[model samples]
Target: MTQPPAAGPTPPPGAGWSGADEIHDGLPAAPAEPGAGGRGLRRGLLVAGATAGVLVLGGTGYAVATYVSGGGNQPEEVLPADTLAVVKLDLDPAAGQKMAVSSLLDRFPSLTSGEDDDDLRSTLVTPLLADNEWGLTYEQDVEPWLGNRMAVAAVPDPGSEAGVAGVVVLAVTDEAAMTERLEAVPADSFAFAVRDDFVLLGEDQALVDRLAAGGSTLAEDAGYTEDVDALDGDQVAVAWADLAGLQDVVPLAEAGAGLGDQALSGRVVLGVHAEDDALEVTGLTRGTAPTTSTAATEPTGLAADLPADTVAALSVSGLGEALTTSWATLQESGIPPEFEEQIEALGLDLPADLGAVLGTDLAVAVTGDLAAPQFGARVRTDDPQRATEVIDRVAGDAELPVAVSPLDDGYVLASDPALADALAADGGLGDTEAFRAAVADPDDAGAIGFVDLGELIDEVVAQGGDDAAQAQEYAALGALGFSASTTDDGGRFVLRVTTR
Candidate 1:
């Protein structure tokens, strides 16, 4: 449903791709011969080496291949047109992990469950390095080529080392030493050529040359540029994908209806930023939706009405409108007949009842311990009497898991009658400190979610009869929350975790 963008506007000054800025001389460009073990083998080694470097560096690794230097900041300029996906990661994994562990210690000073930096390195990094030969020079060779930014492009290929289309990595780094190291590598083992400061690593020398030539770059893609730049530039990292190109590759027969038309064909961008003592991961994506679906404003005091002990809560608005809109489109597209037929086969009338059963705004919350979970829902409908009839009818026929009860201007659906009654109580979640601390900007959130990880872990521990290890792992989590809102181009979802 998302129409691809036309040609992108001119890139702002200094906003060009990194690592490919300057032209340089190195090994003569050669045509990559098919079935030669050299290209494929070297590519495989490069990938493994890069992955090892990231882990060894403790998450400071760039997403794709690189020992960067000698280029502008726009690494994406090197990506070919057939690129199926591009990913970028810029987090200092070590710092992030340290922050998370320290926060966990602050929350549960007595809980001795999580691993320290050294322990993590020994347990995770060392073993992975030991298993791969490329790990030998990961520190000296691979790590030096990377800077704070890196981008990887996945392209289709039949002769790649992985027996699929090969990938390319771009990063900004000083390449003198990197180039020397590559020259020393056995020519029969690997193939690579340095172009100025940019190091292109892939299975095919010809493809790599084409990449260095800078024809039809991903940077030239207007839609991708718009989506990636839309994210906060200060993010620890950023990433984007070419869903439309991918849709073209996979066979139509293999792609089910869910993965077929209306399922995909657009771009997605993701970013991560650390702020307010919370690490936020944000994403913007437009695959099937034609336009941003606006959310109705949730009632101000909805959370305040919940039980004080409620450990988790979520509030979503505009569902009724979304469903109705989707249903209409489905009808126009000839999908409703099949859907209706399926519903009828199951002795149900979905088209006649779905809209009447659900409300425009919905709030669901969880209370009690993990051993005895309690759930509650509040649905705001235009006609409560009709909603009650529909709900009661479903309950009578055991079509639903729980009965729905009428409440003030809405309906309460819960796991138990007592839980429903508790929801109807006068108090709400907004008055609670935990809820306030978890949500970042509740007033503007189209959809909001909160989790008291400490409390949830307590429930997990209570229910852990013999799985002490699993219980301990849960203890490392403190509290987390998320907020969703509509953006001009697409939707933005942000997740935050206040580590314990």
Candidate 2:
């Protein structure tokens, strides 16, 4: 198992954690009006007036609480830390989602070493939980307990701003009436929910990619349609909404740092709306927690200075053209709308020629040459319809003939084979000093990227081989474009070569 990186190089206490869960203030909105019942409306009016008075006259009104939950329970397919390695996501949610599934599908085991209880809570968890509008903010941090099964539920305050990890939400319209809603949930049902997922960026990039494509799937989606008993090693956790509800959080037996060590604390905001559904949940922060286990002091080579710009840069950073060429591989998969949004949200830049290839919703813009790959996905949608529209727009207007087709649950539209053949037949890869020179210049530093020799070798091997290993290798290639072909027995391999 790979060991955690040294603490000496860790990001400053506030580095990656600062914006982990940031909910921008001032989204557009207007004051809610009273409800339908004359008596009830009068009561709500009085409360709103009173709350407003406390704010204007008293000048010490507490913040309104806010929380968000995924509409109902969304099914989850996961590989917790126990079964495999933890996967750190790009601060971008969609990108993180793709990275999660990709890491699992690729087969990288969630190694024992990952963001440990303390590190996760402080760096990755605290900000997410505190930033939410739940009105209860704690600095305690929380992380996924590698070996256990867990679930998470969050009850948000009706009128506050906050951030969250992975949650769906609805607006609440009633404030005072919420007492009934809170009372209805079984006291036991509000125990605790574990938010568990894995990080696949392993010490070895190849190992990480292999796992993303074919890792062991530990937790299957529970469907959440009916009450299901907890699986072995599973824990039932409760979610919290307003300050009144959260007040009891610490009092719960299973509350501190958490049983599995995946807990972090942050601030929560609240809102008291006239209607029960008008309340909005804004952020989620993990709890800052202490642990008993002695952390592994061994260090990995990964740098700890993950600034937003740097992190965003790493989102595109790689060793060679594989990233630049990722369009081909991405083309091979279905366009998951949510994944696309991640790319756009990362705010990566796009090259005109390549941008034309990926469409707008999601495009892997390659920056380095054949060696060092510095690439980023231009993610743009959570709606598949939007993703398809983007594909249509880009492929439809391409200067070259674009062929659109589905593969492995996703879709890819690429330059016509005939056009590619025309280029190949004309010797695009041979005697083309300009292309080779440009591809070899990633190390110029003065240029867009500095290439790495290792990536070049990987690309060559992938271009010649068609085995599972080669397919896996192609994923790590800086260029994210290509098709991995394997023999029936999965022995023979041929990676149809292409570039973004």
Candidate 3:
């Protein structure tokens, strides 16, 4: 077969970064003051502080990853005040207690026996603890204290040798005498258990389960434990606790030299351990508080339960009755600005019907499914490429890395220098496959941004580049978007632009 053009582009791929750049240019520029990207930089330093507030919008349904990247304090409400219930990944009595995860498991009667008593974390438990929401003072505060002449905590050293991540050793001392020793260690760094009443709310459990399973010593033998109530209409809260235990409960410290007593409470758990390993249970103990629950808000005859605030934000008026209300309710309930803006931008009239009243909107969670929203929702863009990219971003933000996906409708032309720089300069980035490879292999410069050979070729030909003939051979790259960036790995593009 006559191969494609001698100076032609590579085999043509499906689509490229065609429309996104266009959309970016056409849409009103976001306020330059600050936003998700700005806030993201802040999140890196302090665990829970926010210097400023920023909002980033993507094509996802809503409430995906536009969160505080800094440790500064800002009053941005992530959830609605009237929310039925807020579920937090928890561990202790069950993998899902709503308190300090480490403490909860320690007090959990049934699963205590299976516990190594030396290790107290689950996969889900660690990440949440690392976040500012939980209020950990520093990394040392979360680390297990080993035995030393004195440790970071104020407890009676449980043993002589303590371990974490399977490394390091410390000396355990008598609680009564170690005051002098404990004084040397920074009280806050070693005082990991300082916050006993810590609590958090999130939407993932399987992830917690995975993390919990990774620990060497099982938190508890919670296989047979029965749920007091069905999870169907309940809000789970993670209970926190220490990975190890104290001498008060066991002979772990016989010649023990003290098992490092850096203890934990029930408010910082990472996952839920519901199954009761009958072998390790003790009698039931009273709990600190009652559990939380929620039920789907059935329609009250209005077309929709739209949030007033979100409605005000969108400024959609002259709308049908039921839909207006439903949308209003949703907006008030932490409806993402990106989603609201897009919906309003669609200019789609709200349908006045029973279905419309009872919001049939689709909601996606990183690790859980939102059974229903009081309003109807759909993943706006059905483009697999766009959808996958969005999902990957969400997962990554949450610290979970999903496989790469295709270029999406949003990966369009852009006049913005920041976005262009993030996309990088490989000609093959405009399409889905190249994007998948890029996101999948971020280390490789070629695989990171705006991939798709055909798209690049199209851009090159449009520009009538000196190497125009060679671009035809790269038909697989697609059309090129004029703007490009070397920002990712710190390289500058010799050329970047869209076709005429």
Candidate 4:
């Protein structure tokens, strides 16, 4: 880390620095800018915040460490059940930094600019190094003591940044030393309180106090726990969010073109883990909105017809059902009146002929060399003859010249009729070595897709002007694949990308 600038003369020992200057009734005013050291420290904090945000995009704390050690309270107990979102980790900051940097290097070599860990550490990490005793205590004692059970949470708050308060909780050791260190540091920005086994820190002192007092606990939140339980815990980090509640606090949710239009009233949980040479970030989003019942997808076995060389494919069961439910949601959201008007303009009865329009089963794929791309769409229907008639009618009404031809179990639709014919002629991706290597146990999945990175990069270079595709990182990536499965209660989706 970067060495902080000089902090000037040291305060006289035992001054308690806890004088009136340090105490605030509520929301302490921003402190005067310190010298160069303080400025560097602030910059470092900003960078660290940015880094933390990046880490969250992919995916802990000491009730957390004890939990990891299998001898203490569960990490979830650190936050009350009312938490809007929480991210828990079992790894220390230093170790996490190492793992993140390593994975990033493997995933994108160009990011390092030819610098090794030591060189990068000196240049990038050095600036954030603090020289105070508080910094020393946190790095050497507090962090190590907390072990793996450190966590951060977003909770409901009327007075806070973005109208939602955030708290960082961690188990403590050497309480006296920790208190002394904390008191010695400048307290203009954050307020912290110590509990029996842990410490709570946040921008709002009252919020931190409430959490420390176990008020409006998130541990008791049924929705939050359900989502958290769904997440894979063996990873480096896991995060849970109450999407509906967050919509009220986060500006992005209230703005147009956001989750509001999608009617995403549910929770999202994600687990982030680092593999041998790749990083995996998987999330599960469950909608709580009352949805119109739609028919379940019936197996069509269309996956068997995709070409062996197919790189990317999207398979859907009961496409008509999914579309119907989605269309209902759009109508209820009251944001897109044009869609209903357009449907009327097309003179199409979606519910009456959705089976023919979208097919019972749908599969789309991008195949062949990236330099020369091929696209194909295949769908299953109960009646192929009737489906053909509806397709022709829609084409004539919309002035779209679409051609649907018979495939194994249904019909194939494509811009070029020859492409549709080509899809029906080949042995499918299920039999290909690339598909087997890229996805795990594809035979049982409800939906699946794959993308060949090498081909994608080549196409990018060919199509993009300038240096868009001139990165070595593209060479490191092999393929990306995603799969989904429906259960009795809900569904699960996973997307995985591997290294070459």
Highest-lDDT candidate? 4
For candidate 2, lDDT tens digit of each residue in 1-500? 22222213323333233332342332222224744443233233223322322221111101101111122221123332122111111111222222322232232122112433122223323444443443223231222112121223232222334321222211122221222222223333222121223322222323333333433343342212111121111111212222223333332235442333333232221111111111111111112222121111111111111111111111122212323455565555566879677556643333333333332223222233333323333222223343445555654554435544432222333344332222222122212322222222222211121122224434445545332242332232221111111112111111111121
Candidate rank order under TM-score: 1, 4, 3, 2
Pairwise TM-score winner, candidates 1 and 3: 1
Q: What's model 1's overall lDDT? A: 0.56
lDDT of 3 by residue, 271-352 (tens): 1222111011111111221111111222111111212111000001112233545555665557677965754654433333
Candidate 1, 57-116: lDDT as tens digits: 223222211122222455566666556777754433335434542443343333333433
Candidate lDDT scores, in order, read 0.56, 0.26, 0.23, 0.56
In candidate 1, position 418 carries an lDDT of 80
Residue 297 local lDDT, model 4: 35
Off by over 4 Å in 3: 1-173, 185-271, 274-326, 329-347, 351-500
Give the range of the ten consecutive residues with the poorest summed lDDT in model 4.
59-68
lDDT of 4 by residue, 431-500 (tens): 7655655564466566776766545555445655432344223555555666666544355556555655
CA RMSD per model (angstroms): 13.2, 26.3, 27.9, 10.6
Model 2, global lDDT: 0.26
Candidate 4 at residue 9, lDDT? 50
By lDDT, the better pick of 1 and 2 is 1
